[model samples]
Target chain A: MEIELNDSKHTRNSWMERFETYLPEVVYGSIDGIVTTFAVVAGAAGAELQINIILILGMANLFADGLSMSIGSYLSNKSERDNYQKHLHIEEWEIENMPDDERKEIEMIYRQKGFEGKELEMVVNRITSNKKVWLDTMMKDELGLSEQKKSPLKAGLSTLVAFITAGAIPLAAYILAYAGKYQIDPFILSSLVTVFAFILIGYIKTYVTQIGLLRSILETLLLGAAAAMAAYFLGDYLEKLLV
Target chain B: MEIELNDSKHTRNSWMERFETYLPEVVYGSIDGIVTTFAVVAGAAGAELQINIILILGMANLFADGLSMSIGSYLSNKSERDNYQKHLHIEEWEIENMPDDERKEIEMIYRQKGFEGKELEMVVNRITSNKKVWLDTMMKDELGLSEQKKSPLKAGLSTLVAFITAGAIPLAAYILAYAGKYQIDPFILSSLVTVFAFILIGYIKTYVTQIGLLRSILETLLLGAAAAMAAYFLGDYLEKLLV
Candidate 1:
C-alpha cells in the first residue's frame, strides 16, 4: 500500500496516544497488582495486621512487580533484536554461498507481483545486482516484514514506571484508610479506588484504540467488577466452609 | 529508513511463524482458562455442589470467557480503526487549509536529516508538485503514520478464537479431576497446565514483535505465573475475611 498524508496537528502532539498505548500493559498489570495487594492487606487487617505487615506486602509488591515487568520487557525486546540478527546472518550466508538460488527467488517474487517476462527479469536483475537490494526484497517479499523496531531497556523501564504508578493507588488507599492515626473506612476507601482505577483502565482504552472511550470504560469496569464480585462471593462460600 | 533487503530467509514461507504465534495464545489461554475454571469448579464443588453446579460453572467460564474475549477483540479493533480515521480526517483538513505550512514542514523534516537550504528546497519542490507526493511527504515527515494498518476485526476474531480454545484446558481438567471419575491429581494437573500455557504465551511474543522464541516464552511465563499466583494466594486469604 501507498503512504497517506494530512494534518500537521496530529503530527505536532501525541502525549495522549503515547499514554494510551501504554495503558493496556500498565492498567492490566496494575489492576492485578492492586487487587492482589488489597487482598493481602484486607486479610492482614482481618487477621489483625500491624501497620508494619501491611507496609511490608505493599513495599514488596511495589519492587517485585515493577522489577518483574521491567525484566520481562527487557528480555522480550532483546529477543526480538536477536531474531532480527539471526535473519541477517542467514541472509549474509545465503548471499555468499548460494547467489544463484537467491537470485532466482527474487525473479520469481517480482514475477508474482505482476511484472512479467523481460520486465520481471529486468527488475530482478536490478535488485539482485546489489546485495542490499537482494536482501531487502527477501525481507519484504518473503518475510513480509518491515522496519519498525524498539529498544528493550526503554520498554522495560516504561513498564516499570507504569507498574509503580498504578501499584501506588491501592497502597495509598490502604494507608489512608485503616493504617492512619485515625482509622478510616477500609472497605469504602479501597473499593472506591479500585473501582475508579478499573474504570480509568477502561477509559484509557479509548485513547489507545479510540473506538469508544465510553465503551472501553464500561468494559473495563465490567471486567474489574466481575473479578472482584467473583472473588467476593467465592470468598463468602470459602469462609463458610473453612473459617 | 528505506526498506532494505537484509536477509534471505525473509523470502521464505512464513506460514509457520504465523501459525506458531497463535499457538501459545491458544495454549496459555486454554490452560489458564482451565486452572481458573478449575478454581471455579473446585469452589463450587467445595460449596456442596450437586456435581451439576460444578459442571455449570465450568461450562459458563468456558463459554463466557471465550465470548468476552471475542467481543473485546472485535470492539478494540473497530475502535482502533475509528481512531485512525479520525486522525486521517484531521490531517486531510490540514492539507487543504494550510498548503504553505505543510510545504515548509516537508523542508523542515528533510533539513533535520542534513539536507541544507537549496538542496532541501529542490527536494521539497519536487515532492510537493505531485498531490500524492505531497501527501506522502506529510505522512512520512510530519505524521509518521502508516496506511498499511490491519483489519481490527481480524485481530479481534483471532483473540476470540484463541481464548475460546485455551479456555478448554482448565475446564476440561476440573471436569476430569474432581467433577467425575478421574485418576488425576487435581492441583498437579491444573498447575502443570497453567505453566505449560504460560510457556506458550511467552513463545507467541516472538510472533508479534520479532522477538526470540525462548525469551518471549520465559517473559510470558513469568507474567502469567505472577498474575495467577497473586490471584490464588490472595483469593485464599480473602476467602477467610470478606466472605
Candidate 2:
C-alpha cells in the first residue's frame, strides 16, 4: 500500500480564535497580578500609610513586577524553543549522515511496541520513506522534545497586559478614594475588590485546571489571603518597631 | 501468543530511594520557603526594624507559610486523586453497564488509528477482552488522565520538611546576631546567605527542570531578588510615610 504524508494546513484564523491561544497566558498573568498587587495594598494598609503613598507604591509595583514577570516568561519560553530547535538540527544531521543507525533506532522503538518480523521491516520502510515523518518520529521518540507552539513575544505581551489589567483591581478603590469619588475606607474597599477579583480569576483558572469552581475560587482566595496577610503583618510589625 | 498481565512486585525500599520519590516536593517547598522567608527579612530590614523582631517574624512566617503550602499541596493532590477515581468509576460503570457503547468507542478509536477490516476488529477485541486493559485504555485515551503516582501525605510532609530546612538559611545570620556570635550587620549577612541559598536551590532545580545550571541559578536569583526588593521597598516607603 502506498503511504500518504501531507503537511497540515495552517489556516488563517479569525480574531477570536487567535485570542484563545493566549488565554492561558492571560489567566496566569491575571492571577499573579492580583496576588502581588493586593499584597502591596495590604502591606501599605497595615503600616497605616497615607492613601496617596499607598496608591503610588501600588502603581509602581504593578508595572515593575509586571515587567519583571513578563521578561522572565519571555526568556524561559524563548530558551525552550531554542533548545528544541537545537536538538531538531542535531537529529536532522544524524538522520542524513547515519541512515542505518537511525533506521535501527526506529526498528527498536516499534519492536518494543510488539511489531516484529516482516511487519516491523514494513513499518520501518514506511516511516523512513517519508523525510518529514522520520524527522518527527526522531524528534519525539529520540529527543523527547515536541514542537514549541507558543510565540514567546506574544506570551510576554499577554502577560504584561493581563498583569496590568487584573492588578489594577486592587488599586481601583484606592484610586477612587484618592480622587474623592468614594467615601468608604480605601483599605476596606480594596480588600473587597481584591476578593472579588480573586473569585473571578479563580473562575477563569478552572478552565485551565479543570477543578471544581468553588474549590478553585477557594484556593485562589486562600493563596491571595496568605500572601497579603504575610506582607501586611510584616509591615505592621516593622512600623511598630520603628515607632 | 500468551498475554502477560502480571502486577509488578512492590519492592522493599531503602530510605534513600524513598527520599528520591519526594525530591520534587522538596525542591518546590524549598524554593517557596526561601523566597517567602527572605521577603520577610528584607521587608523588616528595609523598615529598619530591630533584628530580634525580624527573626521573630521570619521564623513565624517560616512555619506558617510552610504549613499553608503543605496543606495546599496536600488538598490539591487529594482532589486530583479523588477526581481521577471518580472518573475511573464512571468509566468502569459504563464498561459494565453499557459494554456495546464502550466497545463501539474502542472500535472508533482504533479505526481512527488507521486500523481497518479484520485488524480493526482484532485490536478492539484484544483491548476489550480483558476488563483491566479496557479500563486502562479508556482512562488514558478517552479521559486524558494518567495514574496519580505521588502520595498526598508524603508530598505534604516533604514540603514541610524541605520548607523549614531551606527556609532557615535566610534567618541563620539573624540567629547568629541575636546570639551575639556575629558582629557584621545581620541584614547584610542575611542577604548574602539568601543569595547563596538561591544559587544552591537553583542548582538543585536543574535536576527537575533540565534547564542549564547557569540559567536556572540566574532565574532563581532574579525571582528572589524581585520579590524581596518589592517587599523591602514597599516597607521602606510605608515607614517613610508613617514617620
TM-score top scorer: 2
- Per-residue lDDT of candidate 1, residues A15-128 (tens digit): 765554456556545544454444434433433434543444444435544555466556655666776667777876897899888888877664444456665565566666
CA RMSD (A), model 2: 6.3
lDDT of 2 by residue, B1-243 (tens): 112221122345767667766887887788777876777777667667667556655665565566656766676677678778878889899999999999988787545445568666756776687787688657654654556667999898999899889889999998899789989999889899889989998898777666789988998888778867876787677667643
Q: Which stretches of candidate 1 lie over 4 Å from their true place?
A: A1-24, A28-243, B1-72, B116-119, B193-243
Could you give me the TM-score of model 1 versus the true structure?
A: 0.56
lDDT agreement of model 1 with the native: 0.55
Q: Pick the candidate with the highest DockQ.
A: 2
Rate residue B102 of model 1 by lDDT: 76
lDDT of 1 by residue, B79-157 (tens): 6566656766676677689878878887776554345666567556655665655664455446555453445555555
TM-score of each: 0.56, 0.68
Question: Individual DockQ of the candidates?
Answer: 0.10, 0.13
